[model samples]
Target: MAQTSASPDVATRALPATWTTNLHLSSDTGLLQEGLDALEGYRKKDPNKVVVRFRAIGNAPIMRQNFYKITVSNRFQAVIQFLRKELGWKAGEPLYTYINMAFSPAPDDTVSNLFKSFATDGHLIVNYSTTAAWG
Candidate 1:
């Protein structure tokens, strides 16, 4: 069968900034905590290696809701893959994302550069809304 050029029927509503910048990593809290524990293991195993962390962003840990943040002295790749590949998280879902790098300006900042790194760097902050997932 010949492949056809296709277009969507409607325009998509854009997500806010927070979703894109920091990585949410996992939708499930237990998994997120597991990842943190694994990081702790890494800290013990390789004390010399740079330490990275997935710290909770909001004041409370909201159930069934994605709310978190992460910090890395270096080695962003390690944590991104651990959550994205190993954990089998909310990836491939249409999730709302907000991205910025420490005081960077947004609102039409052209996130192509940011988007490239985010393929593996970003966290799954806000949980996936079905409309965002599959409208």
Candidate 2:
């Protein structure tokens, strides 16, 4: 088969009249931007802080205070660090952390996103064990 380019006139005629008129944004931005403002309003804003509840899995030691308020911007690594600090575990010590007793989140995951996705009763339940607790 031979290849042929579409003529500019054919292409221009193919589009609806509204397409040509709306191609350049109007001075009244609202004309082209209607309903977009509502989309912005509907977006869920992330909280500044997220509540994290720590639970011991299996033989892991229990914390005197199990609840903590962590900044939303912090990563899951910060949670591990906080756990080590609270439990008096050294940096090199083995500490396994899980979310909601189900899965382990990556250390780089933002706390806010985790909280938003997996929080229960406004708390991010984090289960910790010195040894590998769950598969």
Candidate 3:
């Protein structure tokens, strides 16, 4: 089962610092598919456990983007490189994110709604804009 945060807000322990970059995966479905594929592949190779999610923020470019931050690990640099090179989630012009989850649940935490948050712990919150326009 997943672990919960100290706060009643229902969160998991933070992950080790992972990656930091950007992507063009818009807020749409088709493009999100590519982003998902890229990310999932990275997760498989990543030593530290991590997860990614997409929240529909209407149809604005700013809204369609995601915020990815190095939630918990120390190897932040390596992960960032992976995101830029291995994965095609490139950084964009004046990227910005508004993430706040110092307390996320474990991967199996009930408080996290079965990881519906796509954030088991502190995550690589990338405020990305995929070509799909809603990824």
lDDT of 3: 0.37
Question: lDDT score, residue 11, model 2?
Answer: 59
Return the TM-score for each candidate structure.
0.21, 0.65, 0.22
Q: Candidate 2: how large is its RMSD?
A: 8.0
- In TM-score terms, which candidate is top? 2
What is the C-alpha lDDT profile of model 2 across 18-85, one tens digit per residue?
Answer: 65766665577776487687777656565588789999998899999999999888889989998999
lDDT string for model 1 (1-135, tens) is: 212422332235434667654455556788679889988975542222222223223332223423333332323343343434323446674322233322222334322333334423444222222232212
Superior candidate under TM-score, 1 versus 2: 2
**Colliding residue pairs in candidate 2:** none
Query: What lDDT would each prediction earn against the true structure?
Result: 0.36, 0.86, 0.37
lDDT of 3 by residue, 32-125 (tens): 6998998897564323444433232234244233444332332434333434443344566222222232222232332123223544365434
The TM-score of candidate 3 is 0.22
Q: Of the candidates numbered 1 and 3, which has the greater lDDT value?
A: 3
State candidate 2's TM-score: 0.65
